[model samples]
Target: MHIYVYFIYLIKNIFILQYILEDKEINVFHKKEGNMEMNKPNILHIFVDQQRFDTIGALNNPIIKTPNINRLVKTGVAFTNAYAPSPVCVAARCSMIHGQYPANTGCFENDLMPLDNRQTLMDVLTKGGYRTHGIGKCHFTPDALALKGFQTREVQEELGVESVENYPYMEYLQEKGYKHLCEPNGVRGEMYYIPQPSQLPPEDHPSQWIGDRTVDFIKENGDNNEPWYLFSSFIHPHPPFAPPNPWHKLYRPSQMPLPNIPDEFESLHTFVNKCQNRYKYRDNGFDKNLIRTMKAYYYACISFVDYQIGRILDELEKTGNKNNTMIIFTADHGEHLGDYRCVGKRSMHDSCARIPLIIKQPGKFDGGVICEEAASLVDLAPTILGAAELKMETHNMDGVDLYSLIKGDITRKYVFGQLNYNGMDFIDADADFENYVTNKECKRAAFSTYMAANSDWKYFYSAPDNREFLFNKKYDPKETRNVVSNPFYKEELKNIKSSLINHLKECGETFGIEGSDWKAHKLPPFTKDPDRGLLIQDGYTPWVDTYIPGYTDL
Candidate 1:
């Protein structure tokens, strides 16, 4: 009877052990499948306004001190050839968020905004259970209209006193007792290349403030179970050419190297010549000292921003979120920095269009890899969504996922950019309107510029005159000469033009020159309103037109 009792006890113990093991297995399955929400990676997107592709030391620039950015490059895949979809600030940023080219989004200029009804990257991420936050210059729309999808903490760089009030960065300046000196040299509209040190302390600079706020956000929410996406945008290394304190003195002007301006720059294109002339008259001259000083301040500003980036990265590491967070660093567009004797963007040159792009995803992708694939800022949205393992309707997006390119699943042959002079006022209306209306080349150069570039060749088409400029990029990387007139490259030019036309069709672009059989047709008419001028007239008045209702006959 005792032996029988021992056998029953042993059988009960086996059943209990089996029950416990099965229960643990069920719990493990729940954690893996049911709690997939907790497995999403955090995204930290760092954007610098008007930063060039060549500014980072890791990308072959030996002079600029971007140690923190170099650290990111060491742990990230740096795209050596990344172009901005639009060279202008608002258009480029709009392309970034919308995952479409400016042509598709109808945001071809600084003043234009993407349609509010259209879904953005932030909208997709927020819907996919990610907290979205924007810290600095979004420039998507005016300050009044908050971006539809994200909680924004803006730090705008407004010029006039009336406009400056209530701006986050301006308010910060007020608190720091430096509100009186907001604009460099007290100039408002165009003060980008002024070579004066900023009067405000380094701590109060916009770059530092942006970085500080980003760190705070990370620390407060890093441990939270929900995934987060933060856009840490900086406005520096862009304007006023003023770096504060030691940074201002960090790079001596005399030691800085000037951009190479070719002897044949005059014969390149009318637009290029116009830019040079505009700067020469506006800034007194593009003298050696002026160019060197601008370069010094620009480099110093980059280094300062790099320092702040280091602090933000340090915070991420301290919070133990480094391995789980994907860090992406890029810029809206690039600065001219005296390239072709120009000081700002709005050109089709590589200096104005190509930007730095770096992505760091620890334990998921190989570190210290350089991706030489041709990519654009428009690819950013799809890439972020892909990295988050989220799915959406990407049929409307013009760009492909960078991950696919990185994984060798896809390839990109050419990158495109658009320069629509929607809001630009290049001439006095009273003095220049007659010439603008009559001179085809002048009008075209002033109105629109379209670009298509691969690794070896680049093609630019000016809409107003239906003129084309082709460059052998491998030989003339600086774009000092227009080679369309050469017989040797005639076939290449024809092919590029055909490719651009096909791209326009793919993006559903109806504006500018409509083409067929490798030939251009009629040019799009210019309307009274510049923003709507590029749109083909179809007897429909734009809502922005300030005309009395039913007064069309007038």
Candidate 2:
């Protein structure tokens, strides 16, 4: 028996060695196929928070000057119709990290982090023999796990008090003798719609700090033989609308255009109207001047982020890793930026759902190719894994490989999105009638929302009121009109609804749909309570009553 067990162990070891050698050979083959200079490609994924698709200059926006991003677009494959699976921060990020939707991951809201044992993109890449590092705002709960599969991690927490010693950004500020400078404008936590110049110097700004740190990392590890995956996430262009120094004055408010509020905005869906009314009553509403000023600040923030990206790219080139690195630029979600009189996310509007996705695979694809393939952020993991010559089980991913879609090997008919208000707030089903309704006439309409969109049409379903909204993208790109009840487009509405139902079934989600027969999706078990650590360890504070437009109280 002992001799037989030894023989079996030897056989297993041989098979493991063969698998490793095969993986290396496959990587070499991918290099040759793509005409790459290295056997393994390094991935530099730069992600910005709350960035809009129209913000990039290459995407035809006349205002913002994103020359660096434009250069990537000029050389990369730009997906014109990319969207977020969930139009919120944590949920969308979870989808990207796990290659799964909110329902599958159980990360349905900003406060809900992924379960500890869940498989992440970093986990896969690290297991595939890549050195993974994460910089800036990872937003992972239990801060220690922020770098789960990352061999090294350096994070700059977004929101924190000076009293907290664990906040890296605050510590950096303290080191610079600029203690308590993050809130220099006297704006407490969750203060929104306040436009001002950053109190810190240009070099001391968080965006600049993130750029400097990332460049340092590249210079240190750029020439290493092992492949690496670095995620440089920036937290700017998300809130406070503050940019330091020259950036704050980069654009003049008077020269900017006003938000495109439709003439029939008041008669639009009740959910939208309610959001607008809430903002108006709560903050006394914003005027034209304030709106333009906010836009200027927002643009300045984007430009600053662009400058940092330029610096990072320059570092990559300096380190001789430019040709072997696959650069991906995208955002977690999009900001409303005064669209429909809204400033934050959490609605079904395109401004909040659509994100910019650009992938530059050296030598594999030509520059300046605009692929109009409908894609989602969830596809990012599989696409990156594919580029690295790694394979992921199809059953484990909700998004398809974007490279296949770009090469015309695979086609997607529609992309989907979801919003679970129940996950956002802790509300009693029987008490919160005003915000959540489950009546037969309007079951699943008030709090939960889902969306389905193809190349030409977009459909939204609100569960609280059983409301359905349909818009034709060819004519109504801004989604100003709801033609769901239009007799001429009855078939289109039905088709979209059917597509969404099929998707829900595939994802094993039964919520939002009005039926009790469907099976509930099996989500990963949370080993720890999501709200246990709060702001000290988690990047966010749950149930905080704040002045932000979209913030809710339990």
Candidate 3:
């Protein structure tokens, strides 16, 4: 009996090794073949929301402990400079699905969404004889479960009450008798940064549910003879940095470092940046303690998520499909975490734009390799489709297949982005988009902003402000110095501006560019109302209201 068990274990390890060391080149599978799943590789895409680039312990972060993410970094190829195409929630998520920048997809902000006409990577995978399933927060518009391409999804949107019907996490809580104890995604608004423990236990938290559901999927499909694409999305470390019980106390505020809140950072802010600051409550009474505690809670939330990730990974190994799967991990965008005295996303600075991207495939670099190339979320779809060895002739993807990038077969000189201030990510953003963009008098609060970044420099142009910034990432990895006005770098600024213009023109999103220069206008920026409270207006009811569960005043 001992010999038989040992023999089976040895065979399983050998099987894992053999498949893991398959040919590096991605070969197409015959879609018409009945047993196509037998030859093709499975894909696992793990997504997190609003996680910054420096949170991984393996990635130079000494304060945060993320062993599972570290495991991925140690075993996969990690890219140090992956940026969101648009540094907001819906836009970046849409770009990942549609394989295009915001300009092309017409979903440049939270208010917009991927139109049903667009072909998604999941759609292509399903058509190519692979099962597609998404679990957790997708944040798609019109209908949360609007199956753009996924065969099905178990949604755990941020706010549980508003997206209540058919919401698995909420139903789980309700059935388990924990529904009255907690609100989704933690308490919100002015208390967004306060450190708090989750009302539910660690095993019952939404993050754990997402992980549990994913593991269950893998277990059920392990021997199904069909390759699959599973997108496991998590909503945490976004805001209200709440972690369950012990995890919430895992990190102390003293251990968490303060954000880069430079003395003059407020002066350096753009129109949209300033508005975001006021709305997020970073404008008043923000200090070192708050930032430190916020970081502590944020790290705790991440550690919790990382713990869940380990469960998913273990299941993959037990199912013996670990090596046959290509696991890609990334976030929609990043958080400010008090960087530049800002609290949330909606800026082109590295604090908000940069994301963590790690991809693990078999037969790759020895232990793992750290890639220094500049990558973007827009590249996600193309990479997935390429890995599945499937192609759709009807659509043109804005990003190149990442294998070309990893192999150094092609080099991307620049990754460009467009911006729309989604007005701080409120639920009814669509109803208020026009209101925020331009008032009745026609003065625009948010302008047409564009960004371009390569290996050395990062540039942004805000047409309404007639403001442009150029940061020498080579010298200022902190992105503190805006050298756009430095006469010594005039030519560098001109060249970057030209490249940005050409990109906009090429993509047909050049509303603020004319001839060879950016269009300049002296438009008034968004101003604060002295009497304005948390509510945008009196008697206004948002489709989804954010409040502290036990305490409502905040």
Candidate 4:
């Protein structure tokens, strides 16, 4: 037993010793046999940032190609009604790990994270002897070298790593002299949604770097029989809408579908849309041709990530971990992709909240069945623990096992979400617009958006607006029309509102209630400082118009 080596590992990130410790040397790996395979299944959680639910090819969205994700859907159970815990990244991700709501984590925005002392899914699994390692982004704020129970991590955060010496991705870029081409998180500010190919080659792209690192990890640990958990997180399909080489030109922009701008619902009228419409997707200058151009790049980014997944899947098969591992794929939150004329996330709309969830474990369940039950990122902790045959140590988790939902042993009546919201998800705008969101009597400063949905209905309420929006998914799947004012659906609205209130109460949110009855109260004013993720570096130039004509218009 390498007891002394584990102490060394304890000092220097536990999973780095993953290469050193194997088998029962420290009891990290069980002796793999028939029964052991059933008992200790490996977990590989593939998480992407800002990917929308409708991008997968097999899922019936014709606009994009995602062959590898389609393979997962073909071989796994796909949850069609999955939603984010909250519509922003950090809130949704922290809630995911803790199996709690955003309010419980006190992270309605990216500014905060659950206290470090809190027991999370990764912590519990590590205690259960899983060798946990994280690659790519976690986006936990007050950015630490280690947070969220990942024994060791090679982060590719949108924000620059505080310790580039320790960050493997950054170090690699530096070593290869690709630092000049590295935008860290692609280009930011005005170019966030613009169509451009990455300056780096395909093999050197950040997504490719992650893919290679994961493949190498599998190769290094495959024969060790370690019951390992690897969070292979990717940073693509988020923004800058850039792909490298052939992928950038993989699609024709003219063929891409236009954004959903419903006539009945003016997106500009919403709080979030107003903040996002500043420059990247200005309402006046953003024509359908440019929207199509952006969609082409967006789809290209997703397809690039998909290719990386294919590499990981192939590696698992080569290492004979294919049947022994339980694979889970999901995103932190969905991207708006110009839905409702909004460029980025922080909306309660399906375009921003709904995500694709696929789980595959060999011989446990039927494949290719689209599980229609409501699911959220908050449910991942309990679900993954269930798959690993371990129990969650956290007492305040707010999720049920998704396997139960699929098997009909339990059902979720609705999936609910709330986000205090943000300023264009921390991207910059003109100074005047910034002042409006921060200092003025803007809607975002005063209201938080709350949402509740099931297969039958989608509901939203913004307190300061003193309005409610209800859309029947069956009749209006795109949520093009608000039926809250219609007398025909008054009873449904009443019942849905009652359900939402009870949910909030259950989650210990008393702010939305007044004496047992549901009531909307104007929230406290947003403070002057907003959490702009990864503050811009020095030598900033103003957003310049490229004047590149879209192929659709040409």
Candidate 5:
């Protein structure tokens, strides 16, 4: 067993050796070396909301500074073309946790229950004896379902039941004396604009509270013997378009770079109508200055979130748990930020669906590995399960294990994504539920959309109307030109359209192997043992872990 030399000096206790070798060698001295086999390295998933693909410094965004995330990218694999199968929060998060597509999970929209009471990634890992904890914005189910895998939850608590309903991060901070972040004022209606932290103390901001809580949790639980899976979901870089004073001043509005927006961008798709409707309600319009200020604050929030991320990594290093910990950083979905004059997700455009996905697997995968192959958020669940040596079935799972992709095996030709095209689901829900749906069902139903891509040519298929978009990504990465009706690529369009239909059939109905591409992997039987917390607790966290660093001091 070759053990390349590296060392760790604990503040008060002992000196430990770090090794560079195969899994077998590490397993040999696992016990005596203080790195037990049973202590299988923990997974730390840091998810940010509404962050785009180019937001990270490592991705060549010289204008937007994100050093902490850049460091993660440098030390791991960055899936450059990663996208959410569904851009909305609930659908995306549900797919992420279950490794199933939104259509399959039935949590296809927000504020919905887990499909068929199915076990989640947390449930599976917890059942397999791993410690689990969750902190921050959980928008999927109601507060009732939010605490399923988490022992403690920090949610959106500052707003009223009508405003705050399922917002988890806000609740966590409001409970911890950070109430000013959500104070309603005359500047904007309640819940529309979360005012910049003018009246609040520094420590009262949501970001700062989340960071503080996470640090405290690490200090307390870093010494635990069992392996753990901790997920911290940040609400920032998700708008009211307000950053705390510190973050607001961190980036200059004039200096913030603007994303590419074609003058004729709105003409490309019918989804822009939805953007038009959303703008009428919020005062933050599509004007250049407003967008610039919003972008600056957004970048500042990104920087602020990065600082909090650094804090978690710093705490992990200080606690001597850094070596055996795997850090996975990504976002729920990307925001349009005025791209195509749209503010947020709910479309299949790059600005809305594309997100940053970086995985830093300590000692296993090296830093600075960039994978250009397409990937989905749903891939994260199975990838994590695979990393921990836990058994995970890909049955009914639409996402492939990303471990292989990270290792440089690029075999995929095309990646697929879709939004629901049915208003029936929306018409069936209550006002609260309807709010969570966000008119997605109606919009998608009004426009059944599908996007298919090869390495260069990308196709966007709009059914019923039969509108098509064909763009050469290599030539026009901005995706400006739509050559769908161009007589030159008729055969190519036919092939892509046929492929999309077949893919939809496979994804839609669980057809068998020759016809049913889905693998029938079974979820283990659910038991009603009261001690189920043993498994569920693998993802446990303290209340304060929801705060972000550099966002608080007052």
Candidate 6:
């Protein structure tokens, strides 16, 4: 019996060593194959909504305790500078599925469809012999075909009863005292005293259900020997900031630093800042303490989401496919969390544009390699399809294939981003929306959101007001100073503007205007006065300071 026990122990150790050796050989085998995986390593794309770049523990943030994500960082490639192509949920997720920029897909605004069926990444993957699946929020319009692609198991209808429309399972949860989900607004909604529904234990949360379904899929397919793509989409840390119980108290607010709310940052956002004063959470009926508690709860939501991810990872490992899987993690966009005194993702700043992207290509890539090269969420579909060796020829994708860099090809110079003032358009459709509709607006005026590489020389242009924001990321990653007007850097400004123009042109984005010499009307400048109706501040024209409370003013 003693000899048998020793023999079994030796066998277990041998198996563990073999696994480690196999992991090391992944990259070598990939290089040798050079774009060939026997059946294409199984793809697991984990997408979360409204997550910021600094929220995870392994990244620069030491405050947020995200153990699972930290583990992912230790064992995968963390793309430090990954950005959303558009800073809105529906738009960014559409880009992720199609590998195309908003301009190419025409789903440039919230509440819009993908515009064409031939464009989604699922269409490509399905044609490639891979089974695609999705779980969680489907915010896009006409979600029918999309659900069919993945055999989606999502919570339809709104999540709470106060909602004008019934979310799929919201009524069920609400009747059981999950009332907080019905509160239209969270801390920002100005409804704090509203009693929160009893926090759902992690096991009962919607995210957990999604994880279980994914586990089932993995187990069923683990031994089938067929490559699969499972997109487990979670909608936590997005709203009400109500991260259920236990999770709500999981982290202490004092330990978690307040977001970098730049002093007088509200002044920078002339449109949103003005409206904020008219609708404080207190005036809307939330208790002051409730608001504070909700803020803490939002952070808790982040931590809770992180915990769910840990659960999914455990399932992945337990199923024996962890070694051959290529797991891609990212978010649609980011939540402002009061940064710049903004509550949501309608701005073009880093807080709204920058997001986290970590990819774990087991056996094909190593852990601890941080890639600082700029990457766009739009590049996601192409990268995944390329890794799966699936042809993306039929789809008119605007993003570049980024699989090489994931396999250790990092000679990339710059990544690109675009903007749509979608929310701004809601406020002033006649101004910006008219341009996109008539195709007359040339630059930022006609678009919603915009971003460019965080190069030593960076330039931000708003086409409507002909406004320019120029900064040197090498000197100021925070983008506090707008040096577009500094005459000392005139040559550098001109060069960057030229490059910007060339980039747009290369992507087949024509403004119908010529040359990089175009400059904003500088003298006397555009301005708004109390006497002149609304101020054309922050390059947004026709922007009015207004608020329309939702939930019947509950």
Using all chains and alpha carbons, the TM-scores for the candidates as numbered come to 0.81, 0.82, 0.87, 0.84, 0.77, 0.76
Error of 4 at 500 (Å): 1.4
lDDT of each: 0.73, 0.73, 0.78, 0.76, 0.64, 0.61
Task: State the lDDT of candidate 6 residue by residue for 1-554, as single tens digits.
Answer: 99999999999999986785565544322212234435477788888778888788788776677898888899988888788877777778777777877666656556566555454677677777777766667566665324535544444321322332324344434555553332222332333223242346666566665666667777777664456788877776666465666766776655555555555453345332223222323222323344345456666767776777787788778876676688888898886665554556645567777889988876544467887777788888877877777767656666666556655555555555565542242233444434445543442334333446643655656544446667777786776667778898899877766666666667666552356544332122222322222222121111222344785466
Off by over 4 Å in 6: 1-38, 151-201, 263-267, 270-295, 406-410, 422-444, 455-458, 487-492, 506-508, 511-554
Model 1, TM vs. native: 0.81
Regions of candidate 1 where Cα sits further than 4 Å from its true position? 1-37, 143-145, 158-166, 184-190, 269-284, 393-395, 422-446, 464-466, 517-554
lDDT of 4 at 114: 63
TM-score of 3: 0.87
384 Cα displacement, candidate 3 (Å)? 0.6
lDDT of 5 at 22: 44
Q: lDDT of model 2 at residue 352?
A: 83
* Lowest summed lDDT window (length 10), candidate 3: 535-544
| Runs off by more than 4 Å, candidate 3 | 1-22, 26-37, 162-164, 364-366, 422-446, 531-554
* Best candidate according to TM-score: 3
After superposing candidate 2 on the true structure, give the runs of residues whose Cα lies further than 4 Å from its correct spot.
Answer: 1-38, 142-145, 161-166, 182-190, 269-283, 393-395, 422-446, 515-554
Selected candidate, larger lDDT, 1 vs 5: 1
Question: Per-residue lDDT for 373 in model 4?
Answer: 82
Better of 5 and 6 by TM-score: 5
Per-residue alpha-carbon lDDT of candidate 2 for residues 326-382, written as tens digits (9 for 90 to 100):
899999888776666666777777888889999986665446899877889889988
Q: What is the C-alpha RMSD of each candidate to the true structure, in Å?
A: 9.9, 10.5, 6.8, 10.3, 11.7, 8.7
- What lDDT does model 2 reach? 0.73
lDDT of 3 by residue, 1-554 (tens): 99999999999999976674465653323222354434577888999999998899999998788999999999988989888988888889988888888778877678668555768888899999898999998988867778888998898887544434677777667667653454546766656666678777888887889989999999988776678899999998788788888898898898778788666685558766765666666676668887898888899999999998899999989987777788998999988888887878878888888899999977542257898888999888888888777885567988877777988989977887877763333222343454545552122224556898876889998755678899999988998878898998998998888888888787776556667887654554354563233423111111334467888974
